[model samples]
Target: DFQTWQLAMYCRKAKLKLTMKSILEEYKCGKVRLVTMLEESDDPVVKTVKPSIKTGRKWKVAEAIDEAKECLRLKEVIGQTQTDRKGLGSSSVKWWSKTEGKEKRDMVIEEVRQREDVRRIQKAVQQPQQGQWTNWDSAMQRSLTWKDIWQMAPLRIRFLIRSVYDLLPSNANLVRWGKKDDPTCPLCHGRQTTEHVLSSCKVALSQGRYTWRHNRVLQELASVISTAKGQSNPPSPSFTIFTTEGGARKWCWRSNTASNQRKGLLDGCDDWEVSADLPEWDEHPEVIRRTTLKPDIVIHSPSTQQVIMVELTVPYESRMEQAHTYKKEKYLDLT
Candidate 1:
């Protein structure tokens, strides 16, 4: 009867049929105890010793022992209570105990203190009036001088003064009546200002192509310097436009007309004046005539001594086709 009961309990717990021989082998291996086996067995001889404890339609003793073992294994692995098992019809105990709660609160407070310290340091670093000439306003005040105001003015101040001169009639007119509302350029009928006249005016842009060319040349020069010396600190190129006899007359004529149009105390003066005269070359003097060039950009190349000349032209499709044909013909002639 004990053997039969053990086989029945084994079948119920394992959810598989257990032969009497397999049950005996497992019992000898000490996997199933004799007492547990006898308690869960359905044999009449075993039931007479202790009536089978049965809650109707609930887990049997064998099934309950198997579940308890599984729960214990899970608890060991995950450090959780068997009663807190999900989908098991059990209530949970609080996982976060008092000690865990205190540790979390301490971490939050430390993070807040760290954030406050960072903000305070940032505020100290960003405090204004901490250094002389640290900002644009202070730099301007420190750079201002009597010589700058009168004769050898800084570039920015000169630009501003020139702008005022171009806008108002004269210094006298400016003193008499702050500044005039007229914003027309005296040299051209375009809008007047340092930025507009020098950078964006159509007439100025046409004349400024030389500036782009000069920039390309400077870039090439820097590249050559870097290659030869194995150093990156190449000096910047100075842009100076020397007027040749051929272009000088034309420039003077234009300047005179512009002066006459303004007809004010500060009208007849040209803003751009260079002390150095144009270089003389008797062989090809007219071919190498001087013109004003402003540099738009500068870059460095890895090869060549003479800077590469890069001309930017927005040519029409027909003009481009003609240029291509001309080049092809020239190559054919050379061949």
Candidate 2:
């Protein structure tokens, strides 16, 4: 019920093979390992044998073998298998009995094959994998795959993610493996680790790399939104996203406006409504306020005297909720 008992299975298989070999050795026979024979036939070890004639003729056929032969003769070459490798895992159920008469060997092979197959299936069905719960395992689950990770990230970024997950060659890992000098953070000169470099380094955060990357993504998105807003007929539901044939997917909307109009396949977006006359979106456009608080981006609809504000936060995965809370508190007055 817990696991496939590999050791027990191997032992049982070994016992069965030993018994089978002893029984067949009395008759000079062996079970061929089919896969091994095919894969390593050129090896100098595998041997082959052919069956010889024992009978000469049938009573009804007098002239059938007047010279020497009568019965159906097949020049079948049977592989002479090694008894040293005989096990329950043997690929061949058939045996080379070194006899022209195959009846006894065939019957033995058929019975053994059928019996072993049923036993193997029953054992397989009864085995299951079980593991003890660990404190380090994640409670929050997200179904992410390699495709999702690799799709938009650069090769360096992909390698970085792999290294992060595998804990490969980082100072912390090197130290764990007892092969390290200094494990100090490159930027902050603190105890260097995967966590420090990715999230906890004050020097890195102070350098504003997080904000810079966040802004770059937003800027590209904003540009695309602005361009899409200008297209005729607005956007509709059930829109399919298509990228330019020869460029990055992010640059999909950068094609000529005239060509987009001709195709009329792409839509402005799912969550956004865009029109030249509806409203205006401005980036950090001097929000007149009692306090110095300003949104990263703003949507101004003059007719309704309303402003929809936006704030972008690019925090480490562990700090998303904290970042969200801070942003919400910072913009409470606007809301």
Candidate 3:
């Protein structure tokens, strides 16, 4: 049956049975003949249908119609011309025929699809053994439709789709399938989850696999900041200083302006220097300080005496807010 085929398609996609209702609720196509029930008083066919049917059950259309007419009363009423006695199509209907309604329906469908994608992503993240993607954008998943998936090689399509749904033959999944006795990671001696092999292994981290990617991102950001407008060399310090006997020192900035007002942050700074923690490249930025804490990127303005530190993190979406908060607090004193 068509319904069975539809259900099978959803199952193939790893979707739940709840989607069956949505598939069956779309507009039905058949020989149109209706004028007995109107679900809403403001429905498009309200003016064309008989007043008795329109006013019969205004409060709760479905329940009232079910109780009164049983299987006879249609849920959605259709407009019919007096002479032809045929139901009017959507193009001829009033409120339902508006272009805004079509646009709004498309927007709602896209929003629902995005939410479903996010739900699937969160489910994958929560899978302890097979979890891999925790920071994927729902928009990217939503953009890949069945048409695109079908175009990929069959083996690739199966592998890619199975990976997303945690159905791949990973160690943990093999254990779940009764094919393996243990799911321990060979290198780290921890549960061999998909994420562990790809990103979270201590041995891999120690070998600088993750750091390589982190530094690559930092290098690009540092390059952008270095070439940004208003980034120039700072002028030489021009000030008068006095040291008291107790070793306390005081300094006054000497400016050409007669206003005697102080300049704001970055007000007179033309040169800004950019630095990053990456040291693998020949033209790598210089280390600004030999402190214990080193940020991913740093932008310093000598003239303004201001410094901006940037810390980059690639955390899971579920822990993104926590990571951001911790980073901000860690750098609060420096700021």
Candidate 4:
């Protein structure tokens, strides 16, 4: 079983057919050496080929083809003539011409590939060992095709393949394999699974490790918003101040609140304020409401009287929906 699973992984990585399916395809295409020789020879020994038995390498090409057809779940249909159809039964299996068979072969193989992919995913979902990947379908919004994988770096490719399959030697795996006596995390003494080590360690959370990482991401985002705000030009005022000629000239600056020249949040405002609730960061927007909610980042346009609040979250893939629901509920009153 281990060897079979290893071979399947290699085939998946290379995007190639499994051994049995490849052999079946070769026979169908008339490329198998034994089948070719059998079709060409007229000797008594060659004519004595029998059906394959369960436990031996010595098998006829026809038997192998039959086994593969069964494994792939391709049903056989028998043809019946109009006069024979009334009597109700047909013994002869339907056969396609060479040209038509090639097209049908491609279609059937394509369908087999799709079904194989679905089965592989379902098996992964049912596996209790890899609990982190249970919500793979929902977590992955966009997946890389073969074209994208081929261009990635070797290190990135290796990491992607290993991480997805839970092949890395985490503490739990080490203990399971008898390499270690303890499976608890070194920092928090919790079960040292991949998710715990990566994101949920209580000691790491208290030590501000997670917060530091979150702040780093938030800082980059704030910089981008600040740059865009600076580059945008603000709209002109709706009205200008007028003064009568006297001994001294007088002018005043006034903003028209009920003017129709207002633009969007980003436009009509040269002074855009952006703040982030990060440690050691000085720019933080003061909360006017009676609440202690500090969003990760805040963008405010005083000219348009508009404000936007952003919250950052980095959770395990399986817990994404739960985290989103919690955030929405927590901020429900403020919104």
State the displacement of the C-alpha of residue 290, model 1, in Å, after optimal TM-score superposition.
29
Candidate no. 1 TM-score: 0.20
Worst 10 residues of 4 by lDDT: 10-19
In candidate 4, which residue pairs get closer than 3 Å at backbone N, Cα or C atoms, i.e. clash?
Answer: none
> Which candidate order results from sorting by TM-score in descending order?
4, 3, 2, 1
State which candidate, 2 or 4, has the greater TM-score.
Answer: 4
- The CA-based lDDT of model 1 is what? 0.36
Error of 1 at 186 (Å): 3.2
lDDT score for residue 260 of model 1: 34
Candidate 3 structure quality by residue, lDDT tens digits, 1-335: 23233322342223322223233112110000122223223577774664442323324323332333321222124333342233455234232234343443343333334434444445545565334434433212223465775677889765654555456677887898899999998888988765566567899889988888878777887777766636433344466566678877765757554234444443456766666777752322343465556777777766666677779976543455677788888767666
What is the Å distance of residue 109 in model 2 from its true position? 33
In candidate 1, stretches whose alpha carbon ends up further than 4 angstroms from where it belongs are: 1-178, 209-229, 232-335
Q: List the residue pairs that clash in candidate 2.
A: 2-128
Which prediction has more favorable TM-score, 3 or 4? Answer: 4
Candidate 3 has a TM-score of: 0.47
Error of model 3, residue 32, in angstroms: 14
The C-alpha local distance difference test score for the whole of candidate 3 amounts to 0.51
Worst 10 residues of 3 by lDDT: 24-33
Per-residue CA lDDT of model 2 for 142-203, tens digit only, reads 33344654564577543543332334466765776689877877777898765566667898
Most accurate candidate by lDDT: 4
> Which wins on lDDT, candidate 1 or candidate 4?
4
Q: Higher lDDT: candidate 2 or 3?
A: 3
Alpha carbon lDDT at 155, candidate 2 = 71
